[model samples]
Target: MRADLDIEGGVVVGIDGSDASLHALFLASEEAGRRDCLLHVVRAWTLRTAPRPPEVPPSTVPSVAEFHDWIVLRTRALVEETLPAPEDRARVRLHLPRSQAVGALLTAAETAELLVVGHRGRGSRLMLGSVAAICVRRAGCPVLVTRPHHRRAAGRRATAGG
Candidate 1:
């Protein structure tokens, strides 16, 4: 995880291994490159439930560290897919925070020039996801909610087909 103190007037982006988030990352990278600033990629995770007995064994259940590791690995892959070139990757800094998505992103945006996130995440409903909505209303910096071009194309295709 990159230290928050290291971030200055850069672009902060929320990444969750979702397609929309990946698109946001791409945009954030472009913005960062244009500004000649670092692109901070943040992934926040929280344990949803405690391990229970009988149905689930403590040993069998993954630990918080394991979950964090998985998120980091997944986020890295997403970044790789978004930025194929080594030089483009060099401009990015990765962060994994153990907190809720909104809180983590809000904190990251405190000192950023711009905050970028996907319009929706893995299990979001409505056109504006809860996280994006909240961040737009409360983030310290400007927020950009990105929806992938392919998603928009699919939506248009569905409308035309119907």
Candidate 2:
């Protein structure tokens, strides 16, 4: 964590560069704007290494730092593209921590006013993603799991007709 960055009482959102995560980010940003609070954007990444044959040299694989940098860069690009408004970008503080997604989000949410995350992130097939589920269970503050727009619309239609 940076010396100047304060996660406490902020609106914390977990971002993974997925469309669902982006939706969560937008919603979190709007909530933060409404509350006049800071928006903390967090993205966690882990490096995976595959076993190499004895004949293979170690130089072929990218270093952990390289992977971390790539993730950070990609995340920043996604944020920039998704949040084009200068005011919206101004209120956000991005954190690209090289750790497990769940742990990072839980830590970020320790003192947050609210923890927001996508209902289902990339590669998630269930109704809720693992990170969002864990955050909802373990976060000290309120948690908002953002559903996909289509699903939300469908749900609204069902409720309105019922």
TM-score of each: 0.81, 0.81
The digit string of per-residue lDDT tens for model 2 on 18-42 reads 7789888877888999999989998
Count backbone overlaps in model 1. Answer: 0
Writing each residue's lDDT as its tens digit, candidate 1 over 73-147 gives 677888987788787799999887777788888888889999999999876767889989999999999999888
**Reference-based lDDT, each prediction:** 0.79, 0.77
Position 22, candidate 1: lDDT = 80
Q: How much is 14 displaced in model 2, in angstroms?
A: 0.4
Residue-pair clash count for candidate 2:
0
